[model samples]
Target: MLTWAGLLTVLAVLTGCTGSTPLFGDNRSPGDAIRIFPEDGAENVGADSRIEVTVPDGRLERVKVTRMEDAEHGQVPGRIAEDGRSWAPDKGARRLGLAGKYSVEVVAVDGGGRRSARNTSFTTLVPADRFIGYFKPENRSTVGTGMIVSFDFNRPVRNRAAVEKAIRITTDPAVEVAGHWFGDERLDFRPARYWEPGTEVTVDVGLRDVEGAPGVYGSQRKKFTFRVGRSQTSLVDARAHTMQVRRDGELVSTVPITAGAAKTTTYNGKMVVSELHEVTRMDGRTVGFGGEYDIKDVPHAVRLTKSGTFLHGNYWESPDTFGSDNTSHGCIGLRDVKGGSSDTPAGWFFERTLVGDVVEVVNSADKTVAPDNGLGGWNLGWSRWKAGSALR
Candidate 1:
């Protein structure tokens, strides 16, 4: 009952224009040839979500998955399957980064020589629990030759191997660096011997979404670099009350000092200066000695041990007390003024020291400092140090 004009209008609306896309846009018979996982506009995707791009009957030309807002760790690495139709991520990148946004761009060529491209985005779910690592030597810092890379985690790690593997260390003018685990919470890395002067070290941490324990995920993904400055170490003779400073194997200064009294002897062994303070409070009560002494202002304090040992300035003692006799409570003291001065022995040494500089104590009654106390890994032999690695 319809006329030719009316019929033509209905046919045009139904099939669209000749050889052109339909009204709803590219409504091809097979739709788009390219297929992307974690489809566009997805939110709260699981960390273990499958991520890939595929074409039903085509060869993938390009596939790039990038993490949003992290330029340092920009892309998620993957490879096209042998069949040339699919792509998958590497084993290390299987798990998506928790609380991270990702963008996927893909390109493929179909059997008919037609090309297709797609761009999609997704956001991963926030974790219920996350573990982070606190690392040492600081980024882009210049430390002494004895500097060691250390990490202290807030929570205990049950999967030590996985966590260790996540940390990648590389050096310029490369040397062999090994990692050692101190129980479950601390990890340290060092070369066989002290690092050569001017050596550049880079640490790449890719622990994001790694399961450190049951249901506990790691959340740090970053890179850090540091350079080794000149080598400076000091030797403290507790029995003789003298400290010898050395730089690059050259004897620089030999200054008078006072070691721990006989009853409270200083620890003997290699120690690293982990902290430096111009002035700090030293209370005997804090270190298990009650009513002995509490100094409100101890100057030029260089921390040597976790058990309250320091090589600091001493103004309260008699001027002659330094070279005469050892009289202190488990500390090495150098004669100094009430307020620290640059001309003083303690001040001169502090100025030349770096955080990673070594301070070794000899001829003391106390046993060698434990390898775990401060950065005392130098106390361990090369073989023993390597054996402590989880990888070993």
Candidate 2:
């Protein structure tokens, strides 16, 4: 339909307008534009290392960092810089797993609206030995004012400073608290004074990847909370052979009691009720005393020390022994029936007591209770307690 010259002109115009563009406009490949940290095939990467991505000439549209073992894939919340070229994971998001293999996928779009994708994988470092800390005052428990947050480590932490720094404690009304180390395997935290009634405390152990020692790494990351209940403290005067119970600082009752005998005296210090049992067996042979007594049904017993000290009912002792004579190996004795009826002194006291209630024993002939003997941390002077802190 057109002349040959005119057809040639049309072809020349078409070639000039679209010759450089292949089929679709600007079909040239974006060609590996995105850069990812912990580069592809990276080994021995830190667990706490932040995953990041940057585009040389584009803006990040989507980014995902997934643990390979769990296949837990989700968009990693990230913040793009003002220039829209650099991106990093959000601060408040959950951290990556420890000793894990991860896959990072990124999608980016340049100013021309061309999309480019990058996929990479890396592995976090594996510790030679993993350590963990078991914390107490169980999560969501309601405890007495004397409750202390204690941690028993599975492995001895040589880098005390690093381990201590990873432990965090916060309170509702806000109190100054400190951690005291008991040797290398135990750490306990408490305020200078007893916890305020009705206060809520939260503990965070962020020990993952913490170098607790050479070639030893901590791998525990957990959070727990506890509430402080009403204040109740019982004062036991060994000289007077009685216990004065107080609630909210008011004398509620004075109960007749008998403490440890003259030879094997009860520990003299502030102690916490660590546990309670309605009926349990007590054997002198088990506590280094060979066959002095073995009661199979000791009733209404409250544990006070790790070394087998208790405030329990002694149905075997005569009624006159209590409030009149100091007798027993190294425990406080209360009058009770053999079967632990609720009406007995031991049962009544046990019903009213909580695990964290404080019991102070005075005028006893024995040396003061060791701070680590039970929940007897309060016996240590404030200066001495703080002196045990690695941070100090």
Candidate 3:
């Protein structure tokens, strides 16, 4: 048994050995000792700005950055410095959105095994003008082999290289594809050759807040897919007065046809079938030949160009003219009944045709179609087509 003085002495020695004075308030929890770049509540940060954090006496365990408006969050991938003192977001994650607020959170652990967290927010600079690119063919659409992925921009892209890099094309059974800029307003993508039949194609345009020029920014983030259908191409020989149709490279039919007359000859080159109709109106004035003819309900019309051009039934003309003569204002005319009978040449052709079918005009007196006239990129040589690339 120990006396009261001895027991008090033992208790004092034990307390002195085990006790620790609290350095952070009364709880002894480690203080948040993180140093963040672009400091807290920063404004007008650059779109390409990066986030970095340093812990003098600790190591980072996790970091996250999120867009405030969309709540889109991404984990910041980083590795501790060899000395284990500093951390930074990956190089690829430096592309922040323009005119947007972002929230950053970091959690770290100290040498004592106590966890600490710090959060910061920032806003990116906003530009004066924003541009967007509208794309086609539409999502989930099944089109023929001649279909080209096209993009039309609302504003001109001066920095063509930057814009082109932002656009991406992918195929399931991968094929090499390239993009060509047609002026500053249009961009088109296609393989060196036509897409293989039944190929699945996907387009991703990640231009959101991309700086296209000094004051012009891009504002589009889009994804769309299309599938290629069976192959079909038609050859229209104006001099021979015939149209030869082929399916999967096999000659299927040869029908007599009348191309445009001498004064208004049809454009000669490759064109894609963009639209088809069983019956539609054809007004000469619409194609710049004022009041020469206005036939309502023309049968089995198929549109070939953005400008008024079509392969259509001509019931007003005598049937004999189709096989032997070329007499019309810039259109290919086939013999057919007024109401589009299935047995007629025009009806038969329309029924078998799908949007994106290729039509090439040969031996015509007219000059070759302008590359931008229709889907006429095929008219350009491979070298010339590649020369139009911004990346080239």
Candidate 3, residue 50: how far the Cα is off, in Å: 46
What CA RMSD would you report for each candidate? Answer: 28.0, 30.0, 30.6
Rank list by TM-score: 1, 2, 3
Q: Per-prediction TM-score, please?
A: 0.68, 0.67, 0.66
Q: How much does candidate 2 score in TM-score? A: 0.67
Task: State the lDDT of candidate 3 residue by residue for 329-368, as single tens digits.
Answer: 7778777765667677777789988878888888878888
Q: Write the per-residue lDDT of candidate 2 for residues 210-304, one digit (tens) a residue.
A: 99988888887778788999999999999888888889998887778888787778789899997776755454544555456555456677878
lDDT of residue 260 for candidate 2: 79
Model 1 misplaced stretches (Cα beyond 4 Å): 1-128
Q: Specify the poorest-scoring 10-residue window by lDDT in model 3.
A: 10-19
Model 1 TM-score, all chains together: 0.68
lDDT of 3: 0.69
Give the candidates in order of lDDT, highest first: 1, 2, 3
Weakest 10 consecutive residues, lDDT, candidate 2? 11-20
